[model samples]
Target: MFNKMSIINKGILTHSFKNINRNFNKNPEIAYTIREKIPSPLYITTPIFYVNAEPHLGHLYSMLLCDIRNRWELLSGKQSYFTTGTDEHGFKVQIASIEKGYDNPKKFVDELSLTFKNLADAANVKYDRFIRTTDSDHYDTVKFFWNLLLKKKYIYKGEHSGWYSISDETFYPENAIEEKINIQTQRKMMLSKETGKEVTFEKEINYYFKLSEFYKDILKILEKKHDFIIPRSRQDELISELKKMGKLDDLSISRPSSRLQWGIPVPNDPSQTIYVWFDALLSYLTGAAYPSKKFKSKWPAIHLIGKDIIRFHCIYWIGFLKAANITLPQQVIIHGHWLSNGIKMSKSIGNVVDPIDIIKYYGIDPVRFFLSETSVLEHDGDFTEERLFDSREKLISKYSNLLMRSCGSNFDIQRALERYGKMNLSRIKMEEFPLFDKSVIEEIKQLQDELNQLAKNIGKSMENFNLHSVTNNFIRILSRSNNLFQLCEPWKLGELREHQDLVIYLSTETVRILSITMQHVIPELSNAVLDRLKVVRTRRTIEFARVGADEAYGASANRGGDHPITRITKRTSSYPDITIKHQKAS
Candidate 1:
């Protein structure tokens, strides 16, 4: 009983916000030109990988997300900039260099950095810039930011005392302390693996950034931009807890010069070195050509990061930027950690899944698709080989089968169009056919409206970084489309020669709808739809709308009621079976 017009209006309302145009400039010069015309530029950055260890699936997950968003922005014609790279500062790297028998920090870090570069390359991330904390330009930028903060009185020399985890490169509060028995040492210790060490009752003088001052400001920002932190629940819980705490202490921003001297020197203070977090987080700006005229044009758009490090990205990073009077990023998309067998994957466990291993087992596309589909943008999600296999079978197989079958066995683009065009001729004169269902047009419109609403809801979830809901909605839509196809029995109609046009019309329209629905998640599949329809690339030109009323045989009035002879073909055996083989050699 839903009016088709009302449904259309509702659908439009739901998805209208998602229609923001992206200005993609493949050439940096062209991107600069486009930046001048755009109201705002979108800058994105991935967390810099520490060079102490090799890249893992968790690292790839973060980078791939940035890549996906970058690609989407490009496809939408947005002037987008993306960055990813290595954090080469810290005692760990210093110790690692010595342990590797490399006298020079640069040489040791460079070797480790290559592993990250190769991993990113294998993942097909088209980052505009790859930053290395050791880069002279990056060093200057970090120092400049630090000096600016210091001049603004936001930084001070202070004595810091806390549990520092070298592994996590983080300090833990009293609450985070865990009493564990060190079997090897035969002693009880309050330790945090996240910090990579036990709490020693000691204090040291170090540079500190005054983050507590912005507690209220951060809260206000969160309130104003509810969508800034995704998976509303995580944002709500995290922000609420912070507000209750009322204040945060200043953060330590330096490492002892004697212990590790391979980092950027503190401005006007050669004896002190910038902390790991300070240098690493600054890569976001440095990678985007910050302080340069080009960087001023495009500042911060969205920051994609793992949930484990949300505190640093969302809190400290924002505080630092605010202290410097710089613009905060539009959004911080926090994704949950990927657990293997219900436990965090670690080198000690020998359970860390290398992204390359998965890529070698599958192809890049399948691995990318599986990760994106399984990752819940705001909550912890499990990553298993079995889950990846199932995703491949369900999403890839079914989707690919739909494409091959819909376009016919020949796979010739021109032939498929011709066949579709012929069917459209019959549907042009629907009034003349006695058996033609006129009410079906209304049903199709209603369904389109429902699809629009679903798309809008999904878009909002995506905007808020609630990828779990996005995947859930995607699966629901796919199920509905499959059910609708089964009930319509377009294959049966192919048997009635006279109704051939009607079958083509319904099938093409259904395919169009399915194709448009996939634009956000599986754009590769959507591209296939555009190719099949032979439509020229145009902005906001949906696949479903490309096939006009004339092409829809159901709308025709000239077609006779007489049924034509069914031309049966062996090729029309349900859907094609798409085989997905592992890329790894047996």
Candidate 2:
């Protein structure tokens, strides 16, 4: 029911607003670009990952969500810029490199950053820019941003004191820090209630951003935009917290370079280094060609990030943008972390999952499919081999088997498609149906109605960025198609002659829709499916994902039991079981 514009464009922030600071550029330019460049390529981003550790399942899940949204935009005849890379500069990475016996932090980050890049390649996460904090342009941008903030009086030298967690690389308020006993040492220690990481009271003179100035501004934006953050509940959580506190503390934006020597130094002060988060967040802008004369990217990309990083993004990043007069991002999406077999992933637990190994064992599409099928925003999703195996099997049995049965060995699908695929059976009266049983005709009508519903539902889902609902819509239609296929017994319908065409027409129509709609989630497999169905490339976009979108395509759809989705073979690679996390202790 959606037009192409409706499917591809989530219009600018629906509310208009005056800037809290009269000097700030604010949303007016953001709105101008959104309106003027309506046909421009969409922009999407994933949080530049921290490089203290190797890539894990949680990292892949974040990429999967970004890739899905980007692919959806692309398939709908829109261009999309996708950016993802490493957050290489941080106290965590500095200490981690020292622990790993690396003398040069650059070498350490270089090696780890490639591992993330390689993981993206292996997982088929097609990123446009792999921006790194260490990149030359990023260095310029960070310095430029720093000077701009200083010029605006948003930066001031101050003594910052708080409960600091080296592991988390952030400060926590007094109320957020609590004493807890270290289980292994059986010793009492202060831990951050927010992250459960041990925190030590640290006080130092550093550069602080006047973050408190923008507390009300951010609260106003959240209230006005209403949908600025994805998965509404999280946005509501932030709004509630913002309203309850009604104030924010000035944020420390730098550290003494003697203590943290591996980061970007402040604009004029070499003795001080910019905060890791302050430097890292600029990767998005740098990747988008920010502050350039030839600014090709429209402002306000949709940023996909993990829930753990929401506070930093909503509070610090927003404050910095407001101060620097940069356009605020259109939206931010927070996804829940992936648990290893229902246990939280932790290095101490030895439960961290290396996603590339799984991708190598099962191939990219299955892993992509599994992640897309699991809804992460509601809560943490548990990734077990059994769960993966189950999801893989259900897809194979329900969709692949259906494809094999309807288009391959069990029926004369080609003949049926040739005869009836172009006809709109819904427009014909009930009396015109060629059927042996009245239920068969009714079933055909039901399948046709469901196919129409599939189109409407997917458009709505994609428009609203409800990713899980898209897959659910596909599964529902696939199930109904399977049921209709079973009732008609198209394999047996051939000799009966009249009933065969109707059965094949209805079932293959459903398969065609499934193939088209599912292309965004499982691209490689969907390509293979479309190839097997003989569907031409041009018709593979979203517009053609209808019941009878192609009649000329199924001339060669007879692959017997062979379907791309039916790849349930024993994996040739021996993937380490990540689910053993809780059972095996470090």
Candidate 3:
């Protein structure tokens, strides 16, 4: 019998993929298991966002996924590289530019690309490189990559005919197209069944990549690495699709320059411009300073992308790399689109959530916490004004409230850290602290052990590329610690110095460790937490997240320990609420 499993994250139902029935224990190892530290010289990336549309929550989420992974490596004291930028070449960008009446598409892409960069800055995305396809270096790289493929005889001129999507910037197989009726105009149209976007018949001569020849090579990568294409549903989709087609058709790699003049020209052949997908995919190499020694030393990158373009990234990109003899990316982490108010965001419905507007309405770190905490890694997530409001309350009430309690005037967190924080777990003798009641010591030890275990749970989840588990783990630890603090009543233990000291030390240590872990998601607020507790700037890496890791800290002058979470209400937000006019025709 097929077991119906509902995989959930933070209460978001993630097992929503249809027709994905599986037997019990078919793929058991996908469970979250503790793993070793991710090796150094790490690279992480988000797909270059296509400039056809203005920035949305979907785009912001992708950038956040990259930043979370990138910052984790940074916090762990490893050398890391991260890259995210705009995909400025393509039919979609060309049409959008003309519709806006811009005579030069470069001028058009220039404006859109800056918006993405600004958004990344506002979201605290510490990207090492922000490459634009129009960059001269990128143009050169795409040309060189194309010439290498041509020299390898993996590319050839051919006549191509298929249904094409301007929105998707790729051609669709015949089985993927569907006939649909326009809701408003009652007009019949052909649309990509996968994307629900309009597709038109196209016939042209273009350069083709032998994508079919690398089908087995790509499949072997998926089969070899079970967690390679994460969120098993996406992996199953590709595997099922591959099994359906023994081998894929050769992919068209160019468009006539006369028809699409806004892209990189084919090497030595100006009449045919390289396909935008090919040009855009080359941004990854260019973003990393490709062909330079600087790019070669890192491990394969971890790519974060939205599920809409999985085919391009997984099929075309993997095939291209296989042919080029380049190592495949460490993994392709796929996420689903965000819906607005229980409905898929649509311009016609006037319900698209402007990320900047939300950022202005809510503080940045809270927004980060909300996205990272509530995001369903495997399936679509719904975003509503109420949910955002609730998430902010959670940060302040549950987490910040605990901070105020543990570090308030009633307890000296600095004194607690200085007294007992230096003792290593293995070196400590439990019988030495006999002045306090054995039960009080026992509870304090339990909390300390629980606090220590939080890092293990969080690390394992993060190692598996599950940010939802990481953020939720933070919330769970804080909530439990808060409950224990209330029960222990450290305030009433006036004569029992050892009892009070142990309780306060473990509690404050919880906040310190939490602050370091939270830095991966909420930057400013986590920094604020550390600053309020007087945690030194140099002692905030992942190494200092344990009990005895930093004994010398917690003695500095306290800064903002009074209310602790006033950063949300008091600080001036860096983003504006200005909404961009939707350019799509109604």
RMSD after CA superposition, every candidate: 11.1, 5.0, 11.4
Local accuracy of candidate 1 as per-residue lDDT tens digits, 352-409: 7778877666656567777877777655667666666677665554554444444553
TM-score of each: 0.77, 0.89, 0.86
| Candidate 1 wrongly placed segments (more than 4 Å) | 1-38, 173-178, 182-186, 192-197, 409-461, 466-498, 509-586
Those runs of model 3 whose alpha carbons end farther than 4 Å from true positions after fitting are: 1-40, 183-186, 422-443, 556-561, 567-586
How do these models rank on TM-score, best leading?
2, 3, 1
* Candidate 2 Cα outliers beyond 4 Å, as residue runs: 1-38, 183-186, 409-414, 433-436, 463-465, 559-561, 566-586
Candidate 1 local Cα displacement, residue 353, angstroms: 1.4
Each model's total of backbone clashes? 22, 0, 0
lDDT of each: 0.64, 0.77, 0.76
Worst 10 residues of 2 by lDDT: 14-23
Please give the lDDT score at residue 36 for candidate 1.
Answer: 33
Question: Between the candidate structures 1 and 2, which one is better when assessed by lDDT?
Answer: 2
Error (Å) of candidate 3 at residue 529 is 1.4
**Angstrom error at residue 427, model 2:** 3.1
- What TM-score does model 2 achieve against the real structure? 0.89
| lDDT, candidate 1, at 240 | 79
* TM-score preference between candidates 1 and 3, better one: 3
